[model samples]
Every structure is written in C-alpha cells, then in structure tokens.
Target: MSNAAVLWRRVVAEAVGTGLLVTVVVGSGIAASSLSPGDVGLQLLENSFATALGLGVLILMLGPVSGAHFNPVVSAVDWWLGRRTGAGLTSRELTAYVPAQIVGAIAGAVLANLMYAKAAVSWSTTDRSTGHLWLGEIVATAGLIVLIFALGWSGRAAVAPAAVGAYIGAAYWFTSSTSFANPAVSIGRAFSDTFAGIAPGSLVGFVVAQLFGAVVGVGLLAILYPDAGRAADEIVTPHTDTTTTGATT
Candidate 1:
C-alpha cells in the first residue's frame, strides 16, 4: 500500500480503537456502578478486567491496520523507538491521531452518559494521600513503553493488543493510579463523573508523569536492547492484510 493509504488507515484505526476503548472503559464502569453501588472499588476492578480483555482483543483485531495506536503516547513512543510507520507520519497525521482519540473518547463518554443517565459521569476526587499514586504512574507508563519497544523489536507487534490489554488490567490493581496509562483515556475519563474521572487540575500531573514514564521506559529499552534500534531500520513486512484482525493478545 502507498504511504498515504497507510497513514489514512492509521487514522481510522485510531478512531475505531479509541471509540471502542472508551466505550468499554466508561460503559462497563457505568454498569458496575449501577449494579453494585456500595462496592465502587469492586466495580472498578470489574471494569478494569473487561477493559483489559477488550484492549487485548482490539489489538489483535486491528494491530495490522493503523498499527493500532489508539493512544497518542503509544504513537509518540513508537516514533522514539524508530518504529513509527514510514513515510513516517508528518505533523499532520500526528495531529490527526491525537484529536481522533480525544474526540472518540469524548464520544464514548457521552454515549455512556446517555446509556446510564442515573449514574454519575464525573469521577470522584480525593486527597490522593497515598504518595504511591505518582510512583505507580511512573512505573506503569515506563513498563508500557518498554513492552511496546520489546514487542516491536521481536517483530511481534502483531500481538500488541493482547500484550497491552494484559498489562493494563494487571497494572490497574498493581499500580496506584489504577493504570490510567493512556493520556487520551485519562483526558476522556475526565469528562465523566463516574468512578474513573480525574480532577481537572490532576490531569497535568498525571500526564507529565506518564510522559516521564514513557521516556524512562524507552530509555531503558535503548540501554538494554541497543541492537533493537538497528533491527528497527529493516522494514517490517506485515504478514497479514492491513484490515486483518487475526492478531494475538
């Protein structure tokens, strides 16, 4: 396929992936909150599990097309790792994916609102007394970048969806930030008053931490697997069609 076609595919994949991801995250949270009002924590746990599964499946389904970015941070990290698509993306495509993700996230949040009118849409605010939340964000984001680089290096980018999903679900409980790992998802969740919301001011800290974490993750990958950079120069000859959804988790 031509580079232009590939870029367009990437944008569409971002939109679909973001839309689906938001639907799963917000929609499931809304269901859990309604069904188990007294057990908000458990509801979040349930949502995380489902979100992980959906993420894995979506990755498997769409990784071949658009490289299954779904998250701007992932795209940025890929660029840093030297694995972003070539002609590579111009500022225009980069701009396109982020907005697509943000808009798609908003659509998901809005849809959840329509679906669960009785439930709260905005996330709750707390003092965040646990200092671990920041630490968790750092670790989670770093781990995410490392995994992406590793997958790309091993020429197993096809399974990124499942790999990412599993990481996200596991990280939710393990990391203090509940693995709000993706910047776009974090921003989208802010729109809802549901269990997932991040306070308006809080986004800055979280995003900064995530960016730091991504840098740390990729930095380590560079240190540990320096040869991967050389390997990255070779074009990845995709075995499946761009639209193929047979990827593994």
Candidate 2:
C-alpha cells in the first residue's frame, strides 16, 4: 500500500477508536445515571466499569491500525518524545491524528446523546472549573502518560490495554475530576449535557491542565526511564503496519 493510504487508514482508526471511546464514556454515564438515579456512587461505579472495559476492547481492536491513541495528548507526547530519534509519529501524522481524534470524539458524544434521546450538542452544564479540579486533571493526565510510556519502555506493551483501562477506571475514583485526562475526550464531553459531560466554559482549564500534565509526564519519564524514547513507537501497543516507516506510533 502507498504511504498515503496507510496514513489515511491510521487516521480513520484514530477517529473511530476515539469516537467509540467517547461513546462508551457518555453512553455509560447516561445509563448509569438513569439506572442508579439518586445513588451517585453507584452511578460512578457503573460508568467507570463500562468505560474501562470498553477502552480496553477498543485498544485491542485498533492498536495495530493506529496505535489506538484516541487522545491528542498521547499523540503529541509520542511526537515530542520521538522527535529526535524518529521513533514515534512524524509531524504529518501528528497533525492528521489530532484533528481526527477530536472530531471523532465530538461525534461520539453526539451519538451517545442521540442514542439516549437527548438533544444533540446540548452543551454540558456540569461546570468543572476550579483549582482543585485542575489539579486533579494534571495529576490524572500525568499519571496516564507515565503509565503508558513506562509500559512501552519496559516492553510491557502487551498489557497496555488492561493496564491503561485499569488505571483510568481507578483514576475515576482517585481524582477529583473523574480523570477527563484526554483533551479530545474533554472537548467531546462538552457537547453532551449528561452525566459524563463537562461544561464548555470549563474546557480551557481542563485542556490546559492536560497539556501541562503531559509536559510533566514527559519530564518524569526522562528522569525515571532515560531510555524511554527508544520504545516510543510501541506506545499504547506495537502496530503491525510499517507503511508509515519510522512514524508508526
């Protein structure tokens, strides 16, 4: 296959993978709220479990096609870590992947809303803006990056699907923000005024915190695993397609 075709396939994988991820998040949240009505704790448990299972399955399904990033921060971190050694995504792939992920995420949220008979693009009223919440986002995102890169560096990529899913599920309880660690997910959640949504007004802070968290995660990786960059291409999981050459991730 041509390089262009391969890139196109990867972009589609990222989009579809991310979209489904958001669907799992928003849809499960809606269902959880409906099922557990007044029991906030039970609702969260349902949402988290469903998200964890869905995410792991999605990663397993799409990892070979696109690394299953599903998050812009993950893609960007891949680019940054591999820029010097050319182990991860190229600039072109990064540009293509990020937008596709974002658009896919938004579409996923809308799909979730429609599925539940809610208005599409309801614009979340759940405002999550606050210093502590931003801190939670930073901590959640940083930990995610560290966990993902650590697995890659340690040649444990095979378990990334389970490990990542478990981490996010746990973070849902541990973090104050319920770990909306992905900027694309954060944006996508804004389109739904449901249990999983974040108000549009709070997006900037969450996104900024996530970006900052990525930077922190990278720094920590540098210190803890100085050779982490060597495994950049294998992040999330290794891909079989070599059509993109050195920019597989």
Candidate 3:
C-alpha cells in the first residue's frame, strides 16, 4: 500500500473510533438518566462504567490503525513530543487526525440524540463554567497526558487500553468537570442537551484549559522521562504502518 492510502485508513480509523466513543458516552448518559430518574449518583455510575468499558474496547480495536487518538490534545501532544525525533505523528497526520476526530465526535452526539428521540442538534444547556470546573479540566487533562506518555516510556503500551479507561473512570468521579479532557469530546457533547452535555458557552474555557494542561503534562513528562519522545510512536498503543511489515513501537 502507498503512504497516502495508509494515512487515509488511519484517518478513517480515528474518526470511526472517536465517533463510537462519543456514542458510548452520550448514549449511556441518556440511558442512565432515564433509568435512574432523579438519582444523580446512580446515573453517573452507569455512565462512567459504560464509558470506561467502551473506551477501552475502542482503543484495543483501533489503536493499531491510528493510535486511537480520539482526542485532539492527544494528537497535538504526540506531535509536539516527537517533532525533533520523528517518532510520533507527522505534521500532515496531525492536521488530518484532529479534524476527523472533531467531526466524528459531533456526528456521534447527533446520533446519540436521534437514538433517544431528541432533536439532532439541540445545543446543550448544561452550563459548566465555574473556576473549579476549569481547574478540574486542567487536572483531568494533564493527568491523562501523563498517564499515556508514562505508559509508552515504561514500555507498557500494551496495557494502555485498560489503564487509560480506568483513569478516565476515576477522573469522572474525582474531577468536578466530569473529566471532559478531550477537546473533540467537549465539542461533541455541546451538541446534546442530555445528561452528558456541556453548554456551548463553556466550550471555550474547557478547551483552553485542556490545551494548557497538555503543555503542563508535557513539561512534567520532560522532567520525569527525558526520553519520552522516543516512545511517541507507541502512544495509546503501538501503531503499525500498513505499508510496512511490523508495528512502529
């Protein structure tokens, strides 16, 4: 296969993987709200559990194709960390991956809404614009970046699916923002007015905080693992180049 074909396949994998992830998140949130009624705790439990499981499965399924980077921040961090070493996504790959992830996320939210008999594009009214929530986003995103890179540096990329899923599940409970660490996920959630939604007005702050957190995470990685960039190709999981014979870890 040609390099362009490989890139195209990877882009499609990222989009489809991200779309399914959002579907799991939004769909489960809708289901939880309906099943639990006024009990917010139970609703959250259901939502978090389903999201964790679905995310892990998606990563395991698509990591080999696109590194399963359903989050733009993740993609950006990968590029930044590996720019000098040429170990992570190229500039072109980053450009393609980010847009695909965002578009897929929006489509997933719309699909979730239609599945539950809601309007396809109802803007979320759930306002999450508090200082503490912004802090929560920063902390959540930073931790996620750290965890992903740590795994790669430690040669434990094989366990990323479960570890990443578990971290997000725990962050959902610990963070005030329910851990919308992914910019794509944040944007996608704004399209729904369901239990998992975030208001459109809150998007700017959340995304900004997430980007800042990525920077912080990278700084921390430099301190903890000076050679973390060497493992960039294995982030999220080991990515196999279709034109080549083996994984690029």
What TM-score does candidate 1 reach?
Answer: 0.83
- Model 2: pairs clashing at backbone N, Cα or C within 3 Å: none
Candidate 3 residue lDDT tens string, 26-94: 999999999999999999999999999999999999998889989999999999999889899999999
Clashes found in each candidate (C-alpha, N, C closer than 3 A): 10, 0, 0
Off by over 4 Å in 1: 83-92, 118-131, 230-249
TM-score of each candidate structure, all chains considered together: 0.83, 0.97, 0.98
Local lDDT at 225 for model 1: 70
lDDT of each: 0.70, 0.93, 0.93
Once model 2 is optimally superposed onto the true structure by TM-score, how far is the C-alpha of residue 217 displaced, in angstroms? 0.3
lDDT tens per residue, model 2, 1-249: 777888899999999999999999999999999999999999999999999999999999999988889999999999999888869999999999999999999999999999999998899999898999999999999999999999999999999999999999999999999998999999999999988999999999999999999999999999999888878889789985666455543
Candidate 2 stretches greater than 4 Å from native: 242-249
Residue 142 deviation, candidate 3, in Å? Answer: 0.4
Candidate 2 at residue 111, lDDT? 95
Q: Pick the TM-score winner.
A: 3
